[model samples]
Target: MNLKRINIPSRLKGLCYTLVIIISFNMIAPIAFAETTFEVSAKAAIAIDADTGKIFYEKNANTPLPIASMTKLLTLYLILEAEKNGQISWDEQIEISDHLLKISEDLNLSNVKLVKGSSYSVRDLFNASAIISANAAVTALAERVAGTEKDFIDLMRAKVISWGIEDAYLISTSGINNEDAQGRIYPGSKENEENLMSAKDMALVAQHLLQDFPEFLETTKLPSTVFAAGTDEETVLESSNFMLPGFYYYKEGVDGLKTGTTDLAGASFAGTINKNGLRLITIVMNANDSNGDGGLRFVETTRLMDFVYENWTYETLYPKGSTLPGFNKIDVPNGVDLSVPIITNDPLQLWHRQDMNKEHLTLTMVNSYEALDKNNQLKAPVERGQQVGELQVGYPEDTLGYVDGSKQKTSVPMVTNGATKKANFFVLSSRSIKNFFSTIF
Candidate 1:
């Protein structure tokens, strides 16, 4: 039988080979890809786990740049620290310095119109600085704490250093742009200083602030409040942070943080959100005011928060009394029972990307044997609920090598489910004889 041979053009043959090669390359490649990344119109940004200090997402996080009014957070930190150390009292009256008043008047900077000869309580000043980003109130608070704005700035630098944050520099207590429209240093200050901080360092500062003075949230969360109520100089100061209530970008869990803006720094924000026992700190710096609406910082912050909340979720890896798979029991040597059921005493929760399914999850036990030889088996006298090991849950990559930037392992304490006592001498001897006979047979 004669077989007919089909003829094809050289270009068509080359195209067929190219298609086959491309198809083979795609088929051999791994199906899993990296998580989707959202676009942020900011110079730098970061999102961190407030509890663990784990970084979830970052862009130019370590590059120090002007943080604008966000510097008030550090100043607030100093004030709160002083209050905690008995160095300052909330109700103690603070006299506005002539220097601060002059700066407020000459520069026409953002202020609560603090009266020059007015003596406002520390609480009132704090409210103005925190809620409205009042420049004069913060400067006055700094001067009260450290005797001079320059000295207070020194303290701010020292505080950031003590927190192991090296990239931050404080020139003004209020984080106002110290340069003029022509980029020249504004006169009347001892030196030309601008507050520069990286997104990561800002997150660290915010974490410290939240942990140290969680009570500050009571003031920052307010959209508007009276600065000095029941007084002649009473003025209604409103929060510049649009993420709070009464603004369009407000979210239920968003509370107590700060916003910043200047020609140099544009718009920036150091925001925090607490939801379902998970608190996250997000910082976005130098976001553009694309629409000139004057809320780009808040808009970017809201976007970052939404992305994080949508892509990540908290799940209980192991619940109490749940026996670990592949490790249902542990051998209890010289005990009343041959083995005891190994179970977790407490639940283990892990924050991870939502795409990771439960079926792909893995758990590994890191056992601690007190008195065991080569086999590392448990000894008798094992009490119920006694911690014997730790169970770690994550993906295989996280469980094995624990790659950085990947999901972190959540470790749960494992314990014995039942009590076990030492076996009697007679029983031990009988078991030894039986083991020897069985080996011989």
Candidate 2:
């Protein structure tokens, strides 16, 4: 067909081309989606809710492996316990023993040089061990506390067993690789034994330490501090935990815990963070320097903390003294009132994913009466604030699948809000007669 030539305006042609490009981009561009999964370079790792022994995430957390200087955390625990029990004082002076002096002289191990005749306070030794992971300082403290490192190891093993940590085996007060000493282990030490622990067990140890001696954080959280200040032999000890201030990979919430490194353990960290009253503990073992810049433990720990804080949060689901939604009243036989009001004795705080649906959460009431009788029934003469049952809150198993026991459910005591008395037999009979006449009518 023959067609007449038509001229189009330049601006109109540009507008038409712009519209076509916008439409094509909209059609072909990838849709953005929220990140729900994460990966780390560590061989074994775990994240736990500090308040509750809840495991939020885990990867080979039960695999036994070398934990390096993280073993010092246990040593720190015993020292604090000793001090608490009046076994040792923080200001008590300890002379530099020959063993400690020898260990300090060895440049191959991390140490704070100790003058053979110089005496230091228990506080000094604790700061050196906690902040800088000084093996010599920690060993000296262990010797002071239990009379020998071997005895200290026995105490450590006993304490771990008491805490129900079965898989852990303690061979040293400090987590030094026994093999690194050219096959010459310390005197009284097993030839081939090394401190081996799983991430879960390590987290448990951390939990116990924090619960028993929260003051230890004062030493671990310091980015830099003086060990023997104002003396001619002054030394400055810096924290190896990079999550602390002034170091690379320093996160805002990380406060204390421990770090370990050895040929076998690689870079391992047991770190704790407090953000807006929500505390978390994370353990990363056998992590390597992915970029060869060092601080692989810190890098992985920071990543895990970032993921957790981004996805999980603590929420108070049920407040104390508030009546349960469906269990507001309980039957009271022969009482002044036919029923009495009941409520939770304490608030229920749960650590859950940020995107979790609060409405889907379930509450399981475990009656205290079940312990007394096979029939789940409470007797009259109930007193205010008397615990009658327990409230367990969590998502259904079908919804969240299998979750860690800590994160699975939060339990709180359910109690009565007011007293109820049993009515006399005559009053009960009169009420029954009136109820029978009303029913007949």
Candidate 3:
């Protein structure tokens, strides 16, 4: 082979062009296809629908596990709620304390460099905490909520319990590791004070968040963000979730959720995607390869979500009001004769079962119609859903959905509606006698 010397500018141009092609190729081929399931060995992991707390897949779902900065969800929840309750105004300015001021100085960390005595609007602080996972921003929020981080954490616990998050513990506002075993602090205290949550509990937290703090969805969907750059040198926050664009499962509906990382917790992620009308939330914890890469978390999230979307198709079980024939309709003596609207308050959730065929059913109706008074308790021992009406609807033995199959009776939940009627002595005596006999019958 003969070697010829090339011009400097031309050689440089050719090298640059070749490098661009190589980079493009690598970027284009981000991840490969793999069989999807919930086979991850994470300490705890779960995937659910944010709108509906449907658990698509889970591993160690009820077991408590260390969650890194994903603790921000709780912090974010309290702050947003406080804002909603008029406790704090988004435009209101507030000063930072020593706790937040110190955290802002941590290098390469998500800090807005908020200065002491330098005031910021609640919105700014809110974005900083949520968008960047700024430790200082959340700590400041904690202080505002309950006068101190310790007390604020108690408030957070109360809120979590209200949302049904059992077994999850929040020790730090930012979920950063700290070794201080102070009595007042929540359990994340021994250089291991990351937020602790299980897949099931986290799902509960997420469900509550979606119901109340839906604005969080807007912030997390951003692939990148620019915050406080003018004041604090304009810190740019690129999303740590790389699966946003150009991924198979990732589409226009992918929005913001929390991500986590720690030596103990590994790379953790809780992400959500809304496609068409179906929305799915995915969680992965403790899937590290010792390479400092978030590959396992990414791969697991993708696999699990893909499995759920592909394997399980949401089917309509029993719809509202549509009656099962062969049942006698009671004559409404005074009220209008309309078929009492029979429906499930919530959809019947099923996994790995898909039969949807109709079968024989038996519906037992009890007279919840009592003298409706006050906020209208039925003035009886029976509560709202204590079988006032039951439809022993036939269900399938096994199917993708839990709809009726081979003539098996499934109890349906029906609630009583308050009545508006003039309660005279005769009406009261007749109803009381009817109720006593009905109970016995």
How far off is residue 137 in model 1, in Å? 1.3
Model 1 lDDT per residue over 1-441, tens place = 111111211111011110001112344554452455576778999887776666666888879998888889899999998999999999999887776666556454677876777899999988989998888888888888888777888888888888887777667788876652123232344344577888888988898888788898888889998978999988888888888878888888899699888777877889999876678899999888767666777877878887877776666655668876666777776787888887877766665665544554556666654434356667887888876666656653222122122344466666788888989999888888999999999
Q: Largest TM-score belongs to which candidate?
A: 2
- Please report, in order, the local distance difference test score of every candidate based on alpha carbons: 0.74, 0.75, 0.60
Against the correct fold, how does model 3 do in TM-score?
A: 0.67
Clash counts per candidate, in order, are 0, 1, 15
Model 3 CA deviation exceeding 4 Å by range: 1-38, 108-110, 180-191, 229-232, 246-252, 317-388, 392-441
lDDT of 2 by residue, 289-327 (tens): 756544888888888887877877666665667876667
Per-candidate TM-scores read 0.78, 0.79, 0.67
Scored by lDDT, model 2 comes in at 0.75
Ranking by lDDT: 2, 1, 3
Judging by TM-score, tell me the better candidate of 1 and 3. Answer: 1
